[model samples]
Target chain A: MSDRATLSTVAARAGVSPSTASLAFAGSPRVAPATVERVLRAAGELGYAGPDPIAASLRRGRSGVVGAVIGERLLYAFRDPVAVQMLDGLTEVLGELGVGLLLLAGDGGPAPAQLGRLPLDAAVFATCGLEDDPAFRLLRARRVPLVAVEGPVVAGVPLVDIEDRQGTVELAAHLRELGHRRVAMVTMPLRLDGRRGPVDADRLATGVYRDTRERLLGAREVFADLPAVETASNGIEEGEQAGAALLSGPDRPTAILAQSDLLAAGVLRAAAARGLAVPGDLSVAGFDGADLPWLAPVRLTTVVQPTAEKGRAAGRAVVALLAGEVPPDVVFPVVLRPGTTTGPAPA
Target chain B: MSDRATLSTVAARAGVSPSTASLAFAGSPRVAPATVERVLRAAGELGYAGPDPIAASLRRGRSGVVGAVIGERLLYAFRDPVAVQMLDGLTEVLGELGVGLLLLAGDGGPAPAQLGRLPLDAAVFATCGLEDDPAFRLLRARRVPLVAVEGPVVAGVPLVDIEDRQGTVELAAHLRELGHRRVAMVTMPLRLDGRRGPVDADRLATGVYRDTRERLLGAREVFADLPAVETASNGIEEGEQAGAALLSGPDRPTAILAQSDLLAAGVLRAAAARGLAVPGDLSVAGFDGADLPWLAPVRLTTVVQPTAEKGRAAGRAVVALLAGEVPPDVVFPVVLRPGTTTGPAPA
Candidate 1:
């Protein structure tokens, strides 16, 4: 490591200053074409890979990398098409900004230490819960510009919020309009403890995840005292388990409102397993207008949020923060998409 | 920026040496508890964020970040459950190694400049086509430790390969045993140029992607002169389009071997559209035994690759490379999962 060639060595060989060598390597117009050619020859001779990025970043005070703190495990996060679409939109803008996206596991995984050690010009809390977030504390301590997509509201950190509460309200209202009174909810994790079961009053009050609580509250607004079952994660299998738990009761609900499309798909499976018709016996609705091509012909009644645009908004906020400007909070609207899965209540 | 607090400023305020302040911030046992307290108090007073990670990384000659070069757009890459599973596995091991995974878009998508500027200890080529990869050349020039999952073989760069050719060979043989003589193929992108439709002899000969070519060759070995339709990307929609094209042709084949389960799902959709009964009028097979909960009661006959294990192997290889060891290339075996989608050819 000590013997590794530095820019100075290349500069000496090229008969130029270290700054001139750097300019030549950067392809800056200040350096003459002949100087750039001479530097390249010298660099090729010494096997120099140009300026060391770490050292260059130290001098520039920017890493050209933005960290996205994924709240769940990488597999679970990637499995959600909503997260993927948001990240895709984010990368599209970040690419134009010339910064790379670095994924850090946020839910008390390896993020705290990584946050302290890794270089990030800014960070976006993609899926982490808002309450008592350890990564948030560490980033704030480091004074790293922070932005969150659909997470908690902090004073300094600009948030890219969707109509989580409003979307579910509209979805519940739609089910209500269809003359379904017996309705139950399949909710995402109310807490980060990986608890999967019925959401008791105590758990509901102590819920740390903002999106889960807000969505649940939205549905409760339409159907107060709505019996809700919680999932360990926002996945299809979790939804299936929760769905089964809800349906097995002596008094099964006529309609089920899942927090996400994946969870709704699982509920649909549970409905299928029990030999019940989709809209004839049970009406199902979900959030997130995620593309479910396999569920073709049976379109889901979901709240279609602007997932990609939300990502792009977060990306733009990060850009604004990096430019030493404070970006305001952005809230996107959601619409109700009525599909084949939701219909009038059974006779 | 110039007025920002530095360690020296805090150290001076605490009446301590800069090195002592550094050790105190790192929570070194050598520093007395009272001295650590004094340093923290001074840091808080002056709004110092402890040690600068950029300067610290420069001193250690490590960035604590590993780059994963995704070959496709972030949305497309995340949409594939196989890619997600693989990345999940990679992140599991990487998290244990205390390193963060940075995503760099490959295939001439803001990667070359990123490769030059971002600090990465090593990189893994997750889904990029092997031939003439600009990211590969750039990383090689930077002398970054490289590991590839199912890509072209490069000297000194350890590869975590699957039984791609062999797995397809067995799958093709199974279809052959079913008395299917007229078999068509729906393949992943044979090239990175986003061309969709029939694969001509020229395109087949010039195909750069190893996995696509090997899988196609395996099927061709079982059924010589097997016609194949190429997809722009690996997705259900792409599969549906390709499936429609294959099914609309005058010479309809008795069986279709899709390169992926997503594509196979699309093929199933096309068959349903035409009122063709699966395994009765036409048998369909696919690669990658992905979990498709939406395609209930209809399991796909495909090859199941240990996607997560492949990712873990790549992670371990990166660890070994960082330890100055040349890890041997690992090739994992694949299994043929016989599902409900495939049976004896029609009549």
Candidate 2:
């Protein structure tokens, strides 16, 4: 190739053995730092992209890949503060352990079509709303050790979950105690099969995602007969749309319980658009108590789950599994964090 | 070690040659798919993480590491939407090609202490933030093929840049067209040295980062005397803080131009806090045109840069450089998009 040089040529130019050049490329701590530096300088002068890993991988039959199986391709899944925070926490743990994350997004993470052929040492299941995703089924087929985060309680797969149901119950009770009788809820997807319209009684039973199912039940357990709507994804816009649709009619709810902070935010925006006051005219609560500091003085009354703890638990489980120890599935507790978005029911 | 099984051992247990087992792992198009299925079924029974990549890396002299050098901690860098989107796009492209990414985030990439010790074939310079990052100096000394993204414009290192200056200028002109002369600005960090606060006439002379300097000049060219408040990072909260401070004092500009969409979101929040109706009371604009469907109805009047194109260009550059070609520096174009956030100056 015109201006480019291969590792062999770089080594030849540096007057070192090809093995030495290889050592330089690996950044092997064992190599004398000076010699590695010299090889790199020579390689740079020769216009090489260090070593071609594709060629090496063909021979070695291994690629340092850790797949992150995400359920959908919605843009918010990546930018949602809560999702990003959880990912950051997980990445912190995995990166320290010398692992890199391959975000295998949409349709069971990086193409369910290549169930067995994908190069991954292990796979972690990451999804936003609690929905029936095929991440478990596909990774299972590949024999990849599975670590599910905030999803169904799948057998044989280790899990990292939060106390989502209990947290919602506490939030609903809190809203009721604040003088709210006519309450409503904005729930996550009720079942798989990618349903996005109005949720019904039968769909609730067939809910595939554990968290969404539990949270909805928790809300019902609190208010007995609370009005509620379901959104396609956990997003502010979806929440706002749901809020608008629910609140548009004459017999509207006084308080709204959203499964996620983004949904709650949308509800707040909807209320604002309709000239309703947050606490004076309406009350709203959210889950995944993330810091929406930009929401300013209007804080969100919600549940705070330990995201980093979830990541650490997953990491510990991976380490244990690798060490041949059966790691028990972990369920981290959630705390009721009341903020300013909620108050007395509408007068 | 422990439960980790190498491909050779799996091959032995399956009573097949290591190469055959490797072929099974590859699932090559030429290989009989049935043979591939059987080899996998056997490998599954042996309790293997497929192949011990750490061991294979040592033996093969190449690690499938396309190390991306980020200027801050992984958490901080990963939080930014722009960085995350670029990473998402880059990974999407590389994943299809079986190239794994190692997000090596720290001042410039990895520290000098880590430069010679990472298993990277070629390193991509990610968000190094236009300073004399020690990481780049070390990568230079070590001769790692540096591919800078929206960073320093080193002579030899291949750069992947978006039209930041042009984009901002177009945005500023749109504001100008709307009859807004007293426009305020919020910018990304002016220097990699962390000397953040305000970039006045004096600081502009000693500006360090090429991208920052270019973007500032591009905006300045439109409104040369316009004063811009410098933010510590390109985040929403920071933008909100900047907006609150700027909008509070004397003669807050009718239009505020933010360098990033996240920051623009913050500014919108700040405006909301003050009961300022967007477009009705204040005209606002931003860059990077991030997906803001969540901030819907009030679509952002911003510039849209080709994010996926930039990532694809970087991927293609790496491929070409690997194939021994002089990959040219790529600077993608931008388009000015008008939305609900901007309107004619209030009467």
Candidate 3:
């Protein structure tokens, strides 16, 4: 490592000033092409590589890396199409900005102790309900610009959120319009700890996950006595379990509203297992209009939130925060996409 | 910014040595409790946060970040279950090691110019056939430790590769044993450029992507005159298009072997579009035993690679390389999972 050559050595070998050498390596037009060639030749002779990133970052006061704090484990998070699409959009913006994405997995609060040493210009809390996250506290202590995608919004940190409540309300109303009086719900985790099973009234009213709480509230407005089962995670298997619990009973609901498309897919699977025809025996509606191409022939009736756009919005907020400008909190709209899965309630 | 408190200032205010002040911040047990408390009070008074990450990195000579270069867009890459599963595995290891994952999207060759300024201690060429990748050259020039997940296995860089040829040969044999005389292949991209259309003999012999080429060769060993269609991307839609192109022709084969399960799903969709029954009209086989829950009841007959294990092996190699130890290249085995998609050809 000591044998490694520096820009100064290259400059000295080229008989050029250090600044000129730097300019040549940076591809600056100020340096003459012939002089650049000479510097390159010297660099080749001395086995000097390009400018070191550490030195460059020190000079610029920027790490050229943005940390994306994912709340859940990578295995579970990557399984969700909504999360994947959002991440894809965020990567698009960050990639175009020339900054690499540094994934930081957080469990609700502040990052792990290991992240204490990482140099991040800004951090995006991609998961929801992070107000109590210890990682968040640590990042705040580091004075890095922070952006939240959903909830527990922190002061001074700009937020990019979706209208989660409105989407559920519309879907529930659509079901009500079809004369579905008995409806059961499958919900996202009430908190980051992944508590599952029958959700009581008190838990529903005081849940930590803002998106889940808000969506549940919206659904309650339509069906005042709608019972819900919270899942351990937003996955098809969990959805299936929740669906089985709800549909196996003697008094089954005519319609089921799931928080995500993947969960709705699970519900569909449970229905199939019981030999129940969709929209005939049960009507299932899901949120997050994810393109489940494999779930063919049965397009889900869902509220289409702009998943990618939400991510891009978060990316924009990050850019703004980095530029020393405060970005306003954003709340994207959601639309109801009627598909073959939902229809008039069975007489 | 200029008035921000330093460790020296806190030390001076606390009337303690700077070394003690540093130890207090680092939570070192060497410092007396009273001295640590004094240093903390001084730090609080001065409004000093923890030590700066950039400064710490410069002192330690490690960025605490590892770059994983994916040679494709995140959107397209995330669509493939195999890629997602592998990434999930890699992240699990890196997380335990206390290093943040820096996602670097590469376009087959060099990284974008912006990436040159990003600080990375080591780089993983996680994508395939990156011998000529510009980013690879840059990382090598920077003296960063390198790990490859697959081919173009560099001389010193330890590689983690799967037995790409064996699985395909086994699957093709299974198809042949079913008395299938005619077979059509839907292959992954022969190159990163995603050229889709009829695949000829010369193109097959001189393909750039090693995995695609090896799989093609494996299939050819059984069906010497096997015709194929190459897809532009490793996506269900691309597979669907390729499938439609092959299955819609006048002289359709008795069986179609897709290079990936996602593509096989597309072939299934195409079959559904044409009202063809599986194993009755056409027997389909696929590679990469991914869990396609949405493709329910029609379990795919495919080759199952240990995707997660492959990623973990690469991660281990990275750990070894960073520790100044040379690790041997690893080749993981594949298994043939016979599912409902393939059976005896129609009589």
Candidate 4:
């Protein structure tokens, strides 16, 4: 085996103790300037790149990395503006804490093996369904600090949740006040299996996703027996597909409530393709107050959740857990934002 | 110190050797299933979560984490559909490789300290200026395998480059053929300093970002003295601000070529705000064949670079470097896709 140079070799070459050499490499003020320069010169000659970060991390007992277990594939999670905004906020706080954010795939992708072997100081269940997650169980077994965003409550795992149910209730109420009696719903995936179509009772009973179930239940509270379609994903195209399915029927509804802003945008496109004018022919409302600059002239009436704030809260929770403190669960409130997309239904 | 449960403790309780206990925990077929059950029962009673991943990584001499140095803030990078798509592709491959992706902020955010301490087997400069990067020097000094995506070439570092310069030339040629003598450009940041406004000679000379410089040079090759504006970031709002600056001037160009699709979308919005009809009054083109579903009805005339392919190439390069093999540099070709936004210059 090739003998790689170590700190002791550099220390011997520099005529300094190993501790002093370590101090010089760490830029400790206790080391004299001349000795530090000599140690660096010796290291340069020996091709020693300070200390192996892995070894140093072992000594510190912290990896300085926080893993974010995203529920969907990175492409899907990133495409969603809400997820991006939350990640942005989370990363901002993690940056301030001098830690790196490591992206780990959740149940939707190949994550099981990587989750078992990767060194993480804490793991955040960002944008994943809370129930029966294998990644959560693995991380918990490893005794890693855990945090979740918008999921069902798990004991000892702090959550950065939002008023998902209440927000949907408010949105449904707004459409009702607008005199829209017949309403249909376009939802995010009811489960992680990526199934799309009508939301039958069988699908509902087996639904494990917290946000999807809560939002559907909330809408049901206002319009009992509201016809709904479940999208394969929370995207514009999926929303459009769901919209077409509802509109093609002879008993087309006046309003469509989508679980995400991207889905609502798709539904609007579907309506436009079918020669339906929003507010005149159909009313649409969406969850997540995402800033869609391209969807101009026609603003979306949606439930505005504090997406970034939720991410920051998750980051803080991780920080607190790492510091050996149990962080309080954070639940952010959502508000109903009325826009051009929703108004009085056609008489 | 408290006596924490170790592999030895579990082995002692299970009446098996330490190696056998470890093999059992790893679910190795060599270990008898009966022995594995005994080990698990012992582990459950003692509260041992397999082995410490950090120590295991030290023994294996691999962290199984690839660091991606993003040039901008996570929020801004995620907002750009091109970056998201590339990340999606990169993660897909990394998932197969059983490696976790650690997101490291480039010179744009807080990253230096975290970079030094994080245990990364390899690092990819995903979207950043290649010149004078402290993170690059740090990683290189640590002897970590390195790859860059669309940046200036460095010795021994393979790049997954796109035809950035050639793509712009094609778009510019298309515009010139359409009788656009006067054309302006909106660029991604010429430098990472977050400066915006009219691109001055000083900004042009000090430009460090390779994509921005290459694309500008390509446009200059076609339209020598093409007026240009630089954006603070590659975002729609930034693009709109730059577009407003370009259009508000007395000498408005007949066509505006944006370096990115998001920026192009913003420029289109700016033109709409000014009541200028696309193709009839002005022509707009963008780079990066990003899927902007929201920007429907008005297809952007731009260069379509294989963005996700670039990301996959980078991932392949990282995999190669980790396997102690030198990977070949990959350069993807781009094509011009003419859309409704570009047309003959108005008389």
Candidate 5:
């Protein structure tokens, strides 16, 4: 009564063994109802509600938590609908597995001081550009199972990625079929230290984000001289900024291809501001066929990637690794969905 | 290395005490750099990377994770931009405090089995209608610090709420000032068992969700015979559905006020579908002045609640409680933001 009460103290007061008390707390079917009631009564009297989760986890060798490293400030990362949808799928699977999702600040990579203290059964690098994160190395050293969703396919780490190049190629093909000759592109950041500006060939060469580079390359395959304006982040505002910069010139491109739906929506806004009717004066298309309810009545021509499925696959891989099975890296396919946004180039 | 290596084995091999080895793994500054290096070398040889976080948490009496109980299905919950913004603010504060956020599924209440397994220093009831949740009771029994936002306020749990009634009253007053004689309202679910239909006075009387009830009352004060349509959920699609149901009648109200911004956006879409110009044919207003980038150019007249600030306040309350301080409950104010959506009620 003098010291902080524990399961042992409750067990001692209940005239039961420590294991019996633990079983009672765990709701083991073997324990008699009478014995469980006695344990509960004793626990109530000693203010010992149950066993400490920390201690229980230590004994079980599992923390019942999956650490999801989200890159960049949540304020920005969460704004992208693709990220939110993927997280939704991931949480759905993890919750079914009776594991809580622990959101860790990756900020493009992991923070060691933060990651070192938290208990995790598995660590998932959800953010891109995590090829050489020291924190990931630390997690590896700690023997934690790793699941990389959108980054470099490291050996032994279960990787989940989409066909970025193929998806972009399909998008470019859609534009080309629509007779879009002078096509401009609004791209996601090429560097971790990204900014909004015209991306030159040299900047593209030094790109760390594999998806960005792959998408750029795929577009270039269609249009040899594809002019692209890279945004600081994958957001509508930045997309709009890119659109304004590209369309302000007298020789505005007949069509604009944005990497994400959010950026594509921005391009739409820019077109509207310039009094250029969509598909009439210019054509616009986007990647990630995200269901943007707000952009209703303006269905975008986009490459639909299985974002939620990608997340679920990552989660299943984590489950497999935890079960001592080596799951193969998964690469999902992306397809083009031609919406009302893209049409034949203007006369 | 014949058996699975542990901290003790590494300590023995390094010629250091077990505590010293642990200190080295924890990166304690007190330990000499050379001694730490020796410990690391010994650990590498024995395949002991570091101390188990579970064991360290047990010894430290802290889990270093805050559990945020999000109600309803994650698919539906994450779709709500308001909830995501609040979570963004909550994470920003918790992350700054070196505490990882553990997202727990509340599903309208709490999943006792799931809550029981999570090791939490604090539990935040971010969802609504949790006055009598078994999961909350379990958390209380475990003596975890409690923080509630927008629900039945318990005696001890720190509560964070917005000026729901006051804000609604202000919105209604704005509609009245706009020379609107007949004003209809679209509300969020009144009860946990919500449906999409016209809500009469009896239904309003038996409503459980306090925010919904309060907002309805505020509107009634302005338009005594204010008819309201209750939606199954607070979504733009639902709002659109509600708008269709409300507007496809002979007695159509000139102005409609929706409880959330998403619902209001639906109303806007409904008007567009019916070939009614917003603010010209029907004036529409929404609540929770959310940053709807897609709803650009047509700025919705809404009551802007400081959602992020509310989340931050809840987080600060959690921090205070963890620091053994009883922080006061917070009641954040909401302000009316006049956009292009509101004008003098249709001629």
Candidate 6:
């Protein structure tokens, strides 16, 4: 253990005034890089951890709080690998700029119970897909500059989104190319709330789920008449429900396209339970490039979204917005991964 | 669009002083419960988004920076579902206190680049089973109150650990009960750092991975002479490496126990490639109650840790330390879940 050192010790060691050293670490451009390095080295030697974030935030009139809105509660959010990856990207970017992440758990509902009431400088959340995503409502009510991800685009709000429609379009096209005609789609919710059951014509007509709508639209672009069964949540159980309903009915589709990897896995489960041979008897696909190792020997043919990149973009959007610049809407490209799941339509 | 309302307006409407309204909304002890509700209603009507977090943090003299040292970069951390679950737990608890998470990336070297450089008030990391993680070194140097998960208890730092040994003991006992004599163990890094090859008596004596060490110790309590092959990392590739090493070896064990579910999945992949039958030729078990919907029909028999709870405990520990209280160590229990992967050892 070392004795706690202060900023003055670092300044003295660096042969610079305390103010100069302070400016360097404070991300001031006026300070020369060489000077900054010198101060940093000195601080490192003295074990000085730099300026207090609380004090600095007060001086800047900013909270330095970067709230990340998960579409669901802690249990659900943690279960989704894609969401975690996105958060990882966001956290990495925010770390560089001395910002902190506030994970606002917005399970099934719009937001966490206390999210809107918490102090936050900016937020990255989903408004369209969530039931009551408090991030948007709270930030919107507070007039806080926000950057949404895979969610609704409120007028004047910037976003870090992906080509959800294009990704699914590519997925659907690939499935179609594999000689698939009858295909069932498992979708995320179709609205801001968690009213999960069936996706009627009315839900599609008045689509509200941002991620779901985009992907559904993309699938429809390729499979114009494909029937989509809605899932309550992104979990596998919900996916299995949609799968059972679709597979159990008469004149079952030859293929199934799940909105998420979890749902795709569930569809596989449903197919297996129904005694359907995978790829040979039924083909299943999913979105989101998650590592489903337990599904070993079986690769899912799906569209892979760069979740971390999306998060980084969101973080960048927050930084830019904080810096008084409106970030252009960012839509990352998704790659269509051809795996073992989708094969030529059964004879 | 709604106007950004302030506490002053809520106070004015509630016919109270600004301080009273602020206290009410802040949920301070000074304010009566009824008065807090009154203020909350007024603020809700006015669309006020509670007190400014930045301002509150400033007044508290802490940035709420709880340095979370993950094993690798941001992307890598997100890739691990278990890690994400734990983090999600931590975030939920911290959110309640308005605390922010500062992610610290670790390369598990003598001098961790990100951890040493980042300005953090306190840190939570694990014993990487390496010589000593650079993140821990820097955090120690800075005298930050520390909380470790899945690592050994360092002096002055509270350990948020699990019953890795107990769970592994139970797992081995279960295998024995199921009629297994020759059993093998596939494990995460035996050393805190890199590829340490196999976990024989010599290497096991100097193993760096705390969880691996403990679990192996517990398994040995039952098996006594279970041959162990160590993986380079927690991913499927590493698991495959160990799996290949195990299967290719002359004395093939009837059953195998993998340290992680992902690694166990890799073993299953290797088995499939080798034309081996699961639960017939070789029954396998793993740790961590992870979601593997893609595995479809095959579930893993493994030890499940309360990842979210571990994270929540870490978050609570940080909050407690930040508030000048020395919290006790939290040891979460791990359960042995018998999935389809593990069955009767052999005929």
TM-score of each predicted structure versus truth: 0.95, 0.80, 0.95, 0.95, 0.94, 0.81
RMSD (CA, angstroms), candidate 5: 2.5
List of clashing residue pairs for candidate 1: none
Query: Which runs in model 5 stand beyond 4 Å of their true positions?
Result: A1-4, A32-34, A44-47, A107-111, B1-5, B24-49, B107-110
lDDT of 4: 0.88
Poorest stretch of ten by lDDT in candidate 4 chain B:
B105-114
- Candidate 6 lDDT, tens digit per residue, A1-347? 65456677789999999899889987799999999999999988886776654556566766556666665665666567787677777776777765656555554222344555445678888323543344566677777787878666666778777888888988999988989999989997775356666577898777656788778888989988788888767888888889999998898999999999989988988998989998998999999988666576688888898887888888889989999998899889999998988899998
- Tens-digit per-residue lDDT, B263-340, candidate 3: 999998888888999978998988889877777777899999998888788778888887889999899999999999
For all the predictions, what are the DockQ values? Answer: 0.61, 0.22, 0.49, 0.60, 0.49, 0.34
Model 2 chain A: weakest 10-residue lDDT segment is A107-116
Candidate 4, TM-score vs. the true structure? Answer: 0.95
Q: Compose the digit string of candidate 5's lDDT tens values, residues B1-347.
A: 29768889999999999999989987899999999999999998887767778888898888888988876666666677788788777887887777888887654222566677788999787756445666778888888899988876789988999998889889989989999888899999887575779898788877767788888888888788799999988888999999988899788888999999989999999988998888988999999998888788789999999998988888899899989999998999999998898889877
Order the candidate numbers by TM-score, best to worst.
1, 3, 4, 5, 6, 2
Tens-digit lDDT track of model 1 for A1-347? 54779999999999999999999988899989999999999999999987899999999999888998888888888788999888888888998877889898753235476668888899999876567688888898888999988776888889999988999899999999999999999999987688999888999999888999999999999999898999999889899899999999988999999999999999999999998999999999999999877777889999999999999999999999999999999999999999988989897
Q: Looking at candidate 1, what TM-score does chain B attain?
A: 0.95
Taking the true A–B contacts (Cα pairs closer than 8 Å), what share appears in each candidate? 0.61, 0.10, 0.45, 0.61, 0.47, 0.27
- Model 1: per-residue Cα lDDT over B239-334, one tens digit each: 889988998999899899999998999999999899999988889989988877778789899999998899899899999999999999999999
Screening candidate 5 with a backbone cut-off below 3 angstroms (N, C-alpha, C), the clashing residue pairs are none
Residue B186 shift from truth in candidate 6, angstroms? 1.3
